[model samples]
Target chain A: GIQVEQSPPDLILQEGANSTLRCNFSDSVNNLQWFHQNPWGQLINLFYIPSGTKQNGRLSATTVATERYSLLYISSSQTTDSGVYFCAVDTQEGGAQKLVFGQGTRLTINP
Target chain B: GAGVSQSPRYKVAKRGQDVALRCDPISGHVSLFWYQQALGQGPEFLTYFQNEAQLDKSGLPSDRFFAERPEGSVSTLKIQRTQQEDSAVYLCASSLGGRGRRETQYFGPGTRLLVL
Candidate 1:
C-alpha cells in the first residue's frame, strides 16, 4: 500500500487569487489523478496526469513521476472552485486499477 | 452518452437495518470501483470490479459489507445490520481500464447514507 500526504490541509483565497496544492506519495506509482469535490459532494475528475503536465481552462496539473509527487494549480480561482481537491494514486501492483486517495486539500474561495 | 449515476442520492436507515446502494457505470467502461468517504475526508477504496468479477475487496470495512456486479455494468453495495459508524458517502467510479494501469476514474455524485 502507498501513503499519500497533501499539504496545506486548509486554504482560503479570494476570487481571482492563485493557489497551488501538492500531493506526495510514498512509493512509485504509474498513475496519478486530481479530483475536485464540489460543495454538493460530487467528485469531479479534474486531471488524469500520470506524468507530464495538463491544463483545463483555469485548472492545470503536473506530475513528476520520478519524484513521486504531483501538483495541482488553480489560477484565477473562482467561487465555483471552492471545495475539497483530492489527489489519488494507483500503484504498479494494485489490482484492477484501484486508487488510493490522499487526505485532500480543502479550498475555500470567497467572493 | 452517460456518466456514472447513483440512486436515492440520500438514504436514512435505522441501526441494525440493512441498506442497499446502487451504481450505474458508464456504457462500455470496463472498470468499476466503490469508495467510502467520511465527512471532510477523502474517499477510501472499498472494492474494485472488472466486468462481473470482483478483483479486490480488501478495503471493505467488515464482513457485513458486500458488493456485486453481476452483469459487469451495474453494481450494488449491501450493508447488513448497519450501525452509526456506517454513516458516510458511498462513491462509485468507473474507468476504461481493462487489465493494466488506466487511472481515469469518472466519479458519481455519491449516495449519502445516515444510520441512526
Candidate 2:
C-alpha cells in the first residue's frame, strides 16, 4: 500500500491570492492524479500527471516521479476554487488503477 | 458526452435496512471504480471493475458491502444491515482504459448515505 500525505491540510485566503498544495507518496506509482472535490461532493479531475509537469488555465501541476511527490499550484484563486484538493495514486504493480487518495488540502477562498 | 451520473443523490435508511446505489459511467469508458468518503476526508477505494469483471474489491469494508457491473457499463453498490458507521458519501468514477499510463478518472457527484 502506498501512503499519500498532503501538506497544509487547511488553507484560507482572500480572492486573487495564490496557493501551492503538495502531495508526497511513499512508493513508485504510475497513476497519480489531482482532483477537486467541490462543495457538492463532486470529485472533478484536475490533472493526471504521474510525472512531469502540466498546466491548465490558472491551475498547474508538477510531479517528480523520482522524488515521489507532486504539487498543485492555484494562481489568482477565486471563491469558486474553495474546496478540498486531493492527490491520488495507484501503483504499477497489481493495483489495477485503484486510486488511493490523500486526506486532502481544504482550501477556503473568501470573497 | 455526458459525464458520470449517480442516482438518488442522497439516501436515508434505517439501521437494518438495505440500500442500493447506482452509477452510470461515461459511454465507451472501460474502467469503473467505487470509493467511500467519510466526512472531512478524501475518498477511499472500495472496488474496481473492468467492464463486467471486478478486478479488485479489497477495499470493501465488510461483507455487508457488495457491488456489481453485470453489463460492463452500469454499476450498483449494495449495503445491507446498515449501521451508523456506514454513513458516508459513495463516489463512482470512470476512465478510458488500456495499459501503461492512463487517462483521468472522471467522477460522478457521489451519493450521500445516512443511517439511523
Candidate 3:
C-alpha cells in the first residue's frame, strides 16, 4: 500500500491572495489527480496530472513524478474556493482503478 | 446522467440494520469506484468495478460490505449489520477508461450514512 500525505492540513487566506499546497506519495503512481470537495460534499476534479504541469483557470498543479511529490497552486483565490482539497494517486500495483487519497488540505478563502 | 450520481443523499440506520446505497455512473463509463470518507478525512478506496465485473474489492473493511455492478452502468453497495463505525460518506466515481493512466474519474455528491 502507498502512503499519501498532504501538508498544511489547515489554510486560510484572503480572497485575492495566492496559496500553495503540497502532496507527497511514498510509491510510484500511474495516475494522480487533485480534487476540490465543496461544502456540499461534491468531489470536483481539478487536475489529472500524473506527471508534469497543468493549469486551469486560477488553479494550477505540478507533479514531479521522480520526486514522488505534487503541488497545487491557487492564484487570486476566491471565496467560493473554500473547501477541502485532496490529492489522490493510483498506483501500478492496483490495476483495478483504486486511488489512495491524502488526508486533505482544508482551505478557507475569506472575502 | 452526465456525471456520477448517488442516492439517497443522506441515510440514518440503526446498529445491525441492513442498508443499500445506489450509484449511477456516467453512461458508457467502463470503470466505477466506491470510496468512504470519514469526518474531516479524505476519501478511502472501498471497491472497484470494471464494467459488469468487480475486479477489486480488497479495500472493503469487512465481509458485511458488498458491492455489485450487474449491468455495468448502475451499481449498488450493501452493508449488513451496520455498526457505529460504519458512519461515513460513501462516494461513487466513474471513469472513461480503465487501463490507461490518463483516465479521469468523475465523482458524485456522495451519500451520507450515519449508523446510530
Candidate 4:
C-alpha cells in the first residue's frame, strides 16, 4: 500500500493571505486529486492532477510525479476557505481505482 | 447534470442493529466506490464496483459489511450488527470511466452514521 502524508496539519492565517500545502506519497501513483472538505462535510473537488500543474481561480496545484509529491497553493484566501484540504492518490493495483487519502491540512482564514 | 447524491444524510442506530445507506451516482458514470471516514481522519477505501460487478472489497472492515450495485448506476452499503466502532461518515464517489482510466471521482455529501 502507498502512504500519503500531508504537511502543516493545522494552518491559520488572516484573510487575503497566501498559503501552501504539500503532500508526499511513498510510491508512484497513477491518479492524484485535491479536495476541500467544507464545514458541512462535502468533499469538493479542487483539482485532478496526476502530474503537471493546473490552476482554477484562486486555487492551483502542481504534482511532481517523479518526486512523489504535490503542492496546493491558495492565493488571496478568503474566510470561506476555512476547512480541511485533502490529497488523495490511486495506485491502480490490479486495475483497481481505490483512493488512499492523506490526513488532510486544516486551514483557517480569519477575516 | 448533478453530482453524486446520498440518502439519509445522518443516521443513528443502536448496537446490534442494521442500517443501509444509498448512493446515486452521476448519470453515465461507470465506476462507483464506497469509503469510510473516521473522526479527524482521512477517508479509507471500502469497496469498488465497475458496473454491476464488484471488483474489489478488500478494504471492508469485517464480514458485517456488504455493498451492491446491481444496476450499475446506484449503490447501497449495508452494515449489519453494527458496533460502536462502526460510527463514521460513509462517502460514495463515482467516476466517468472504468478501471485504469484517469477520471476524476466526484463525491457525494456522505452519510454520517452514529452507532450507539
DockQ for every model, please. 0.74, 0.67, 0.68, 0.81
Q: What is the lDDT of candidate 3?
A: 0.93
Listed in order, each prediction's TM-score against the native is 0.97, 0.97, 0.97, 0.99
Query: Which parts of model 4 have CA positions greater than 4 angstroms off?
Result: none
Q: Candidate 2 on A10-63: residue-level lDDT in tens? A: 999999999999999999987899999888988988999999999999999999
Write the residue-wise lDDT of candidate 4 on A23-87 in tens digits: 99999999999999999999999999999999999999999999999999999999999999999
Worst 10 residues of 2 chain A by lDDT: A90-99
For model 4 chain A, the run of ten residues with the poorest summed lDDT: A90-99
Q: Residues B49-111, candidate 4: write the lDDT tens digits.
A: 999999999999999999999999989999999999999999999999998787899999999
- Error in Å for residue A79 of model 4: 0.7
lDDT of 2 by residue, B55-82 (tens): 8899999999999999999999999999
Name the candidate that leads on DockQ.
4
- TM-score (chain B) of candidate 3: 0.97
Docking class for model 3 is medium
Cα lDDT tens digits, model 1, B18-108, are: 9999999999899999999999888999998999999889999999999999999999999999999999999999998775857589999
Best by lDDT: 4
Please give the ranking of all candidate structures by lDDT, highest first, separated by commas. Answer: 4, 3, 2, 1
List the candidate numbers ranked by DockQ, top first: 4, 1, 3, 2
How far in Å is the alpha carbon of A24 misplaced in model 4?
0.4
Off by over 4 Å in 3: B99-102
